[model samples]
Target: MSLHDTSSEGRLQGRPQTGSQPAIALIDGNNFYASCEAVMDPSLLGRPLVVLSNNDGCIVSRSAEARRLGIAMGTPYFQVQRQLERLGVEVRSSNYALYADMSQRLMATLERWVEELEVYSIDEAFGLLSRREGEDLSSWGRQVRRAVRRELGLPVAVGLASTKVLAKLANRLAKTQPAHGHVFDLEAQADPTPWLEQVAIEDVWGIGRRLARWCRLRGVADARALRDMPSGELRQKCGVVGLRLQQELRGHRCLPLTLVPPPKQETCVSRSFSQPVRTADALRQALATYTVRAAEKLRRQHQRAGALSVFVRSNPFNGTSFYSNSATVTLAVPSNDTAVLLAAALPLAETLFRPCHPLQKAGVLLLQLQGEEQLQHHLLQPLPPEQQQRRAALMAVLDRLNRRYGSGTVRWAACGLQPAWAMRRERLSRAATTRLEAIPRVLAR
Candidate 1:
């Protein structure tokens, strides 16, 4: 059932092909990070490109040409440097700022075409497409792709089907096969199962290596096999998710096409080495740096922590001596103020520090977190009015400055020198908006 062999007997699927019924459209931008790079530099068009992780460490995404060289994701840049150079693969670091800004613009652009939109990933989104009088949904998909290209300068592939799962499968086919790369509509065929059967189980959504093995054990090897399995059995084995997948495969629309908001994180911090931090001071400095970050997150959330925990550990997996230590301290009063939180935790860090064990990682954690509330004013833990006022004023100014400029625009001296703890990302795209220099600018000819 290849795209090239469209025969007279194929016809279309028995499902209603009219526009009145609900149809799901899954949109995926091709080689998203590489596309991000290409959008910034038009010279990158049709060129081999690879994007690296933080600190220019390893490959994260590669263009089609680069992929043809057998380079893989997470392959250390140093390990494949010669091979990449020989293949002329352009490299860049993980420019999150650039990628994030582009993703936002893409979502905003899609908002114009459909009534409801669900952004699944930075490069993937789903929308409900309804037929207008005498209008073809396939043609509409081309228009959506054109809009993204014209407005955002990024190429996209679209898949249309009766269900979200089918739409996603169509999207995958649209990517692998250039003919379907532009548009894939399951309703246009009498039977899409033949095409669906070609997709491997592991490639399907929610079926990772472990699940794929489990599915293989049950003789379900492809999308069609899993689709045909009894829903009751799938529910019993894989729980609600497997049931949802079963329904989606059967085009029953069990899963809602919904946008996922960024999740609320439980903790936030930055950690680094001391002397290249082969010592306790380096570990302490790293912990202190993260303490500021944790406190800032707490205040930003309008919350406070009742306890602070500091941890220091050697690089265990690096074949070094295993040394790990951690200490937790209860605060007299829950507070988001940096001075109060750091004051409570710094002493604890000292207690947790090992004697010159070449500390590799250190971090701070805030526990028993709660939103700020009107205090009962405990007499035993009362702070002097002037001291409290000073603390509040100091933190306010620090937060303002950091927000206006950027993180680490100002830092407490105790946090120590920035370590090479950051993941290596050499071929990084420019930070399109964060720093003064990294902002994308229009150059007048």
Candidate 2:
């Protein structure tokens, strides 16, 4: 059935929508990484907090207090070290394990109420609603928000709209406008012209800076302006994509929610070092570790890559003798098996290494990815039936054990004993929640 053609719906609370269906709700966690930290340690609440990216190089997540202090995303740690110390703002390394577990709990709570859902990111999801007469969407949204907060201790905002893009806009508004509560209902508003005018064209979902500039040149400066654009002219200017976005902005469903996120085309694992590496073996170890990590993800996704590439380079800081090199190889057979990947990967890493050169970073890239069932076995290099079965079983066992016991419970020999170039996480918080051994203790009075 077609959605409501007229924009004459009433406000959300206490009145049932006289429309065809309920609007899509975009529910997202607020300051997710920082919130995760604050939830675990109550002491960090209301204090300026920042979560650094890999290697503690830059600020990846910041709390509201941190923002008020002028800390921007991607600001290098070195640039604000003095300010952070002087202001007594706490810092933490990105603890992906804790964040992942909390995210699982958060989504589990949302899943109880929302059956048709799409997880857009680690901290964001979209849910479809079923409206009944006399039901209040605002009340329903608050219940969802409160449930997540009560169970998982994670705060979320909801934006309900006729389409996904509008829902995204509504979610943003929900965060900025907290007085009428953290739910924005576009479907309930008779006219959202005032709020639509405030949202810059650049802020709309699926519209990039380049597209915003293109739209601005045509006098479509805001969401309302873009929605009011002439369809034929927009089609001529930005092709069918812009036309569809225009239709979506005008409360039409042009895109459907993807319940399952698609697999990535290319998987690359790259990280900067805590300290400069001066040995070939160290660079080899880094490459081997990354290869194993990438292979784990590939196997988890039931995928295989036909080719692998490795690269190593000198720290750009020491400008005198800077050098970088890379090598790629096509595998005889595509397999997500760690042994198979490292067999092709470590040799390439050795070739890229240079004696006496300072290594700043090294990585592995898996390319030409395809599903495991679609593999083209090599006739010349075909493995014995028994040997192939054993390898597959071994890989499966490693995955299961690691998942049960935690990551790195099983790995290949080439990944090395000591990772000299690992990230610097000196200020990492206690892993009392995720790690069994690190669980907190109580002292009797």
Best by lDDT: 2
Over 193-247, each residue of candidate 2 has an lDDT whose tens digit, in order, gives 8889989898898899888998899898999999998899888978999988988
**Model 2 misplaced stretches (Cα beyond 4 Å):** 1-19, 133-136, 316-318, 443-445
Worst 10 contiguous positions by lDDT, candidate 1: 9-18
Clash pairs, candidate 2, are none
Give per-residue CA lDDT, model 1, range 277-393, as digits (tens): 555555556677788889887877777787788877777766767888788888887778987787887777668766757766677888877766633345797877797668778
Winning model by TM-score: 2
